[model samples]
Target: MESVRTCVGCRARAPRAALVRVVAIDSQVVLDERGSMPGRGAWVHRTHECVDAAIRRRAFGRALRVSGSLDTQTLQNHFQRNG
Candidate 1:
């Protein structure tokens, strides 16, 4: 069965494949492109708007259950480059 995940940015529920998986490692938020990262994962829509919303509202940290801010440059670039 396909899994459902909620987007941290938009709070919309969707199929796992429709969103990008992110995880915190070494205080850095990285995209789990292959969805194989061994840690808690957060889901976000594959769009700049959704990513910006998540960053603007600091949802990544909360969704990932991390303290303090996370560097989302890499994440932004990843989406923007491919968006």
Candidate 2:
């Protein structure tokens, strides 16, 4: 069976395949397209609304258990290109 995860932005439960996995590396948020990154993972929908909410609520740091601001430019770029 497919795993379920919560979207940090909307706080809604969704199947793993319905959401995208994000991970932190070197204090930067990176998109895990393959969902095989080695680190704490946070899941969120690919919509700009969800991404915006996640950033607005500062959910990444909390979800990833990090203690400082994280760079989300890469995340934004992904959305921009794919959005």
Candidate 3:
């Protein structure tokens, strides 16, 4: 069985291995491409829609429990990178 994680954007629980891990560093959202980051982590579906939702709703901030800015540039970069 796969581990399960909840998306801060869609708030849907899914297999951990099926989700993407995101971490917050200095109040900026960082994609944990390896899922081994050493800080609080948030999970989101590995889809553009999910990633956009998290950014649109500021769910990353809520999930990471930090109050600060989000680097949309990096998020867009990730989306573009995945394309």
Query: TM-scores of all models?
Result: 0.94, 0.96, 0.87
Please give, for residues 10-53, the per-residue lDDT of candidate 2 as tens digits: 99999999999999999999999999999999999999889989
Q: Cα RMSD to native, each candidate?
A: 0.9, 0.7, 1.4
For residue 30, give model 3's deviation from the true position in Å: 0.9
Which candidate, 2 or 3, has the higher lDDT?
A: 2
Assess each prediction's global lDDT (C-alpha) against the native: 0.93, 0.95, 0.83
Tell me how far the alpha carbon of residue 47 in candidate 2 is from the true structure, in angstroms, after superposition: 0.7
Candidate 2's C-alpha runs over 4 A off are: none
In model 3, the clashing pairs are none
Q: Tens digit of lDDT per residue, candidate 3, span 1-83?
A: 77888987788999988888988887678889899999889998888888888889988878888888667578668777886
* Tens-digit lDDT track of model 1 for 15-45: 9999989999988999999999999999998
CA RMSD (A), model 1? 0.9
Model 2 lDDT vs. the true structure? Answer: 0.95
Using lDDT as the measure, what is the rank order of every candidate, best first? Answer: 2, 1, 3
